[model samples]
Target: MNQIDLGGKIVVITGGAGGIGQAIAQRALASGASVCSWDNAPTAAQATAGIASMQVDITSEAAVTAAYADTIAKFGRIDVLVNSAGITGPTLTVQDYPLDAWLKVMAINLTGTFLCSRAVVGGMVQNGYGRIVNMASVAGKEGNPLQSAYSASKAAVIALTKSMGKELAKVDVRVNCIAPAMIESALLDQMPASKRAENLAKIPMGRAGTVDEIAAMALWLASEECSFTTGATFDASGGRATY
Candidate 1:
């Protein structure tokens, strides 16, 4: 574990209770940054000494506002924001996809990321330094079969990241996203075994990525060393991403 210096930085990670999110939080703390996790459920047990946990419904504007306010009050400033909150909607063909289910996925995966990013970007712009890392998926780049909602939502996220990154190009506030292939996490449990195998087959590495691997890339993007890149998609898909 090569330590990246994050001293004096304050990071806010959404969906911070999940495996990948928690891994990112752990890395941030290890790098000397204060972390505040925002999630829909309780994740206090995951917090260490320098980390704080807050329950937030990212889909709700009011809840997101209050949560960011609480985070600001506690940390005084948000140096980095990681929009990691998302859900894998049920596996269904677009023709048979449930309208309610599609809406739910969009509400959480896409709109939720937008809400969280909007909440912190103002302060970051004012301060002239910020890093926003949005969690996108390889499925976003290459549309997965029977997962139209999840794929479309993440594709929108990729677009959003590019647009925002370019918008902030001169502001010292970099925005980027990672397009990771299937990762080994609780989220995978949502998929049927056949679906999981089908997804895995696309990865040339023949293995799912670890949370630590994703966290490492995320940490780099959140660091000053990632100075030259913005509005770019970093691939952690193990050759699954074709473009």
Candidate 2:
């Protein structure tokens, strides 16, 4: 492994239950990092073998706050944070979109990042070093048809990553994001076949990206090698997003 020596580092990954979360956790562990898993559906028993698991609903401010505080209490300090929790909003137009679903997606995809980051800011500040990576989507860039709310919320996440990256760059803390194209995961399992195919057609690579691919980029971005590149977004569009 071309590791950055994360053995002694304590890393926290939200949505560490399935899909990319599990993949990222495994990569970090393989590189020798102590992981604290956060998710409502934490698969710590199954997905993670040695990682610490704490079940917490990210949308709830109190829950996320307590989760981070508890993590710090146990790990002593937080070196890396990856916000991977998200949801695919309703497939409806802006006018017909369900209010509840829109808000729910935004809560998990955007507000949850804010809540967790807020909870960890003090610990990172005291430690004088931190790495934060938020997960955005290519949909956020192109604005998927019939998925207005999801696209908008993700777009906000990208903006927030840039904004926070700049604000925290003055200190040792750095923030960034990954905007991935359609990846093969349960996130799209609920969509109609036609809708799913539509997304696949847009990817010039002619196939969906694997969870490990995204995880690899995430692992690197969370490492010390990524020091010079803060306030930036890395593309994982598989040749689809050439612009």
Candidate 3:
């Protein structure tokens, strides 16, 4: 189609303070989109104070609904929503994994996505146009050891993207996801070096992905330029993922 002009558009990005999230926000801002950046804490001032900043708990439907209300009240429309807030549960096998931590990760990475999508769907249906880019991880596809919760949660995200995409296929909202391999972020420090090195070795590209790479994919998915692809997993695995 045409160039992806996010100019004058309104986009809501959860987890906008951290690496990938911050990168996505910067790209969107550069394209001229008014971004509503949400994290568990306060941020967005440095990136661009003009952008909206809100403290959000992704698992809280009430909080999400209120956030959407604020966005609509202020901007009058929601053009895009990016669910990037997530966490990796404790490093342990399924047998030793704590139920509480597992539940928490699932609630945020999976359920939180459900809540935010539900909150935004109405406005999107009303506007007859919307784009959603959910973040899944290569961990979900390859099932890394010591990361059961994170992998499961992201797998659910992939499934949810497909189901939601089909549900809204005729309604003008497009839903898609990116399954990225290990990236250079604070998240990497949580893993043991051996496991991390093993992962890096698998990538034919021989390195971790950068936040800008993921952000660039998000920009296209959020753009009108990305048509005919929905409910699909776009890979940014640095050649690590094989089928």
| Highest-scoring model, lDDT | 1
Tens digits of lDDT, candidate 2, 66-136: 88789878988899999998888767778888789889989999999889888887778788888898899
Name the best candidate (by TM-score): 1
Q: Weakest 10 consecutive residues, lDDT, candidate 2? A: 42-51
Candidate 3 lDDT (Cα, whole model)?
0.87
> Root-mean-square deviation of each candidate, in angstroms?
0.9, 1.3, 2.0
Write one digit per residue (lDDT tens) for candidate 1, span 1-243.
888999999999999999888899989999999999999974657765557999999999999999988988898999999999889999999999999999999999999999999999999999999999999999898899999999999999999999999999999999999999999999999899999999999899999999999999999999999898999999999888879
- Residue 42 C-alpha lDDT in model 3: 55
- Error (Å) of candidate 2 at residue 27 is 0.5
Worst 10 residues of 1 by lDDT: 42-51
- Candidate 1: the clashing residue pairs are none
Per-residue lDDT for 186 in model 3? 74
In TM-score terms, candidate 3 sits at 0.94
Using all chains and alpha carbons, the TM-scores for the candidates as numbered come to: 0.98, 0.96, 0.94
Per-residue lDDT of 91 in model 3: 81
Cα displacement (Å) at residue 214, model 3: 0.4
Kindly list the per-residue Cα lDDT of model 3 for residues 51-127, writing each as its tens digit: 67888887998899888888889889989999998887788889999899999999999999889889998889899
